[model samples]
Every structure is written in C-alpha cells, then in structure tokens.
Target: MISKKMADAINKHMNLELHSAHLYLSMSSCANALGLKGAATWFSVQYREEMAHFFKFYTYLIDQGENIELLAGKAVPNQYKTLLEMVEKTLVHEQLITKCINDLSEQAVKEKDHATQIFLQWFVTEQIEEENNDRDLIAKLKMVGDNGYGILMIDAEMGQRVFTPPPGTTVMI
Candidate 1:
C-alpha cells in the first residue's frame, strides 16, 4: 500500500501536470494570435503531452488504490509581448517542473518506496529532456533577436514537430 504522504504528494503533482496542460494551451492560443502558426502547433502538441503526463499520474494513483482528488487549477496567462518572451516563460516553467520532480524523487527515496522511485525515474529523465529542449529554443530565439524572417523560419521548423506518445504507455494523446 502506498503511504498517505506519498499519495498526497502524487495528487498534488498530478494537479500541477493538469495546470501545465492549461498553461501550454493558453500559450498555443497566444502563438496563434501572433500569427505564428508553427509555434502554435508546437504548443498544442506540448499541451497534449502535458495531458498525457497528467493521465499517467492519474492511472498510477488508481493502480495504487488511492482515491483521486481533482483540484481546480489557477488561470494561466494567455498573452505574451513576443515569442521570445513566451519561450522564456516556458523554460522557466520547465525548470520549476524539474525541481518538483526531483523533490518527489527524493521523497520516494526517503520513504524507501522502491516502486515509486522506479516509477519516477521516467519523469526524472523526462525533465532533463524538457529543460534541454526549452534551452535550445531559447538559444535560437535569442540568436534571432527580433528578426522577422528568422522567427518565421523557427516557427516553420516548430510546426514540423509531431506528438509521439511515450513508449509502453497506453495513454491516449
């Protein structure tokens, strides 16, 4: 049986994952409004991925025989002064998420919950990839620095990204 403390933490993290989905969806809308359709598509895909992450947590909680608590999420920003600002915010948000995942991993270790620790390993690795991607985009955006043609090229490249569900997960994206 999962400890109460661990269960509560998972619940809280699950809600955060849901909040991330909303944040990305809002970002996608902002990109679309700015005429960056490619960036919009990229955010849309990211939104779906966040939803999948939320579901993964949900399923794990259920499998652990814990009751699920769906908490209301706070509103997310829907406007940005520029694409660079949006990407910068994304990186900041991703860094926060990485920290949260690390905290959860530490908690699992403290509780000696081997199963939970193993489960969180995926997220620990995922956070690394997430932060790296954000950093890469931030670097590109900085390099372009208010160049319209450059921004458009980046947007086109972003639009080429497609959502791929993590292997071995049955979560619908």
Candidate 2:
C-alpha cells in the first residue's frame, strides 16, 4: 500500500501534468494568433500528449485506491516577448519537469516504494528526450535567427508529428 504522502504527491504531479496540457493549449492559441498554423499544430499535438500524461497518472491513482481531486492550475503564461523567447521558455519548463521527476524518483527510493520508483523510471527517461528535443529546438532557432524560410521549414517538419501511442502501452504509473 502506498502512503498517504506518496498518494498526494502523485496526485499533485498528475495535476501539474494536466496544467501543463492547458498551458500548451494556451500556447497553441497564441501561435494561432500569430498566424503560425504549423507551429500551432505542433503545440496542439503537445497539448494532447500532456493530457494523455495527466490521465495516465490520474488513473494510476484511482487504480491504487486513492481519492482523486481536481486541482486548480495557475493561469496560462503569456510573458514571452517573441516566438523564440516562447520556445526558450518551453525548454526551461521541460527542464523543470525533469528536475521534478528526479526528485520524485529519489523520494520514492528513500521511502522504499519500489513501484513508484519503477513507474518513475519511464518519466525519468522521457524527460531526457523531452529536454533534449526542446534544447535542440533552441539551438536550431538560434541558427535560423528569425529567418522566415527556416521557421517555415521547421513548421512544416513539426506539422508532421502525429499522436500515436503504441497499442496497449498504458502509463504504468
């Protein structure tokens, strides 16, 4: 049985994941406002991915016999001054998520909760990919440096991403 503290912590992470989905959805709106349809599409895909992640953990809580609650999220961020700035902000956010996952992993081990530790391993590795991808975008954005042609090229590339989780692969949280 998981401790109440562990359950609450998982719940909090689940809420944060949902909040992140909303945050990305808001970002997609901003991209639409700026008329970057391809970028908006990419953000939309990301938004959906975040929602899946949220549900994965939430369902895990339910499976484990924990009471679920709907938590309020902070307002969608609207502070980036430019598209590149927004991408940079995204990279930073992903890094923060990686840190949170690492902290949770450490806590699970310290509590002798092997199940959580196993569940967290997936997120830990996922974070690596997430951070690397964002950082790579930042690097490429810098190289392109507001060039319309480059941005469009990237926008086209991002548009190709489709949400297709593997069959029967649930978030074993």
What TM-score fits each model? Answer: 0.98, 0.92
Q: Residue by residue across 9-89, what tens digits does model 1's lDDT show?
A: 999999999999999999999999999999999999999989989988898899999999999889999989898999899
Superposed Cα RMSD, model 2: 2.5
Quality of model 1 by C-alpha lDDT: 0.92
Off by over 4 Å in 2: 79-81, 166-173
Off by over 4 Å in 1: none
In model 1, the Cα lDDT at residue 81 comes to 88
Residue 164 displacement in candidate 1 (angstroms) = 0.4
> Distance (Å) between predicted and true CA of 31, model 1?
0.2
- By TM-score, how accurate is candidate 2? 0.92
Cα deviation at 112, candidate 2, in Å, is: 0.7
